[model samples]
Target: MARIKPQALLLQSKKKKAPSGVSVPTIIVYILIVAVMVFSLFSTYKYWSRRSILQTQDGISNRKFIERKKSDIPNYALISTSKGQITVELYKDGSPDIVNEFIDFSQKGHFKGMQFTRVVKNFVIQGSKIENSEATEDWTSRGKHYSQLNTSLKHEAFMLGTSKATHEGGGFDLFITTAPIPDLNDKINIFGRVIKGEDVVQEIEEVDTDDHYRPKTPVQINEVTLKHKT
Candidate 1:
């Protein structure tokens, strides 16, 4: 030891020293913490998503709902199509503007002869644009402009609504959703919900669509007939 060089002594000391390491329990605790944090974040995200939808619904509650006799609590619309028919119950009790606009349009035959312009499986099947009703086998002939309808309704599956008609547009065009679309609730002017012919809506959504969302085989909205319940 007395003859050993300073560098050699230092090396020997280092060699004898054990490497530091975390205990097994400490590692397990860290893993549990990470897992809990991940779960907490996921739970929080889910909670907020649900809360947002509810908030939009609450907003809908504040709007004007149509007053009707007890027997006529639910209004109805018959959407006749090539594949089949879909019957929707207008949310007239809680959405008057939306229900009124739809009734007016249907009585005027504005929804007839419109094709299923865009169809996305499990999401939405957009109806032919109003301008396209006059077209021959084409929807792009008229400029893409959706007329805005005056309403405070929000979009939801089966419910009817309107907005400007651009990619950022709403109102003039129509669509039927096959599933719940929380994102659309706040942006769309919803007024109706499918009651009898939901299967028909599902059938249309099952149609084959092109890359551009156009159905390979056309599904026409043969006509939209409205009726009041007795």
Candidate 2:
């Protein structure tokens, strides 16, 4: 009931006042922290999403290649060479575009006078376009095409492969292996194999070659005839 001094009353009133609201700087800092957390989460989600898409695409491409290898086609090629007549079973299903192009060129007599450019004993024999050859088609305009190297097909003995094309123009080059080459299994596009004339392939392999594997005696592909199962 005693009369309170004015200064004492004022001090008591200040002490009883409610605490002020959070400062503007503190609120702004909290908002910035939340924004940073949201951005981090969004960026993480996008990185994983892109990775998943690439994985799915790779799986699809591999599956399609396997399916094509399982398919069958009734086609063959008889390459009459200076050494002998070598018969091959074309893998049109595995490498349809390359096989078809080879068949078309053979039918059009494009390989009439081409010769085996390179040969390595117990390795491979490669065919290339030679100057002044009897190829009637104008090969200058022909650009490089996909070799379709990835497939179930392998580089076994007597297997035929199409070398990867080059910028200087080399889609039609043929490679015939004389032995199983595990190194080139997934690297070369194998499209056929020797169904006949195993001895002929061996004979070609025995031919003398220079240090660079170029045939000393130019082995010629006299003719290439495409056939179908009757």
Candidate 3:
């Protein structure tokens, strides 16, 4: 038998030995892969969480809702405008938050001089505050921002709804539907319906508007008078 050289034996042994530790590049790649997975999971959870919250507000998710007493809430709101008075029967039991918020804003004269900025022929008549150059409109100025959503509430004809610009919570904007907007039932907060003055709403809807649906002859809300239950 030929004796193996010591140098060759040493080289062979070195080759047989396993690596001391993983390479820095391999470890870095593993870490990056794990981080990506974690971030993806977190993003998914966040999206579902927000969606669930909205569902809960809509009374579709598994959450209990405490209702407020009708006596404590306003019964009706008389929206006096340039055209005529629009009497809205408040949905005190259905959307207390929105009803109360509307009362607060109206009593404060927030919509006193506001204009009906948008009008869709057969859709909706939207009103928003006319902000002065020195003042910027901020929905947060109101107490608590609410995105009132209830399955029972619907966007029927002449239904008074919560502001559409509620992404930043809520706003003083109000919209009256000209026709049944079933699509908006789950999207917007329906707080009241026209108890009277459907003709006035029709009259406003008939006004000539610009390309953007703005009333050529400016229409404004002179006052909003709340009528509480006796």
Winner by TM-score = 3
Model 2 ranges off by over 4 Å: 1-74, 130-154, 167-171
Q: What is the C-alpha lDDT of each candidate?
A: 0.67, 0.74, 0.75
lDDT of 3 at 212: 59
What 10-residue stretch in candidate 3 is worst by lDDT? 135-144
User: Model 3 segments beyond 4 Å from truth?
Assistant: 1-70, 130-155, 167-170
Predicted candidate 1 versus true structure: per-residue lDDT over 1-230, tens digit per residue: 56989999999999999979989999999999999999999999999999999989877765433222323443788888998888877877677766766677677787788888877664567785543332333323211211122223343455455543343223356767655554565446677777787778878878887766678998898887777761
RMSD (Å) of each candidate, 1 decimal: 21.7, 13.1, 17.9
Instruction: Report the C-alpha displacement of residue 102, candidate 2, in angstroms.
Output: 1.0
Q: Which candidate, 1 or 2, would have the higher lDDT against the true structure?
A: 2
In candidate 2 the C-alpha lDDT for residue 14 amounts to: 97
Local distance difference test, candidate 2: 0.74
- For model 1, the stretches where C-alpha displacement exceeds 4 angstroms are 1-74, 130-157, 164-171
- Number of the top lDDT candidate: 3
TM-score of each: 0.53, 0.55, 0.57
Question: What's the distance in Å from true for residue 29, model 2?
Answer: 74
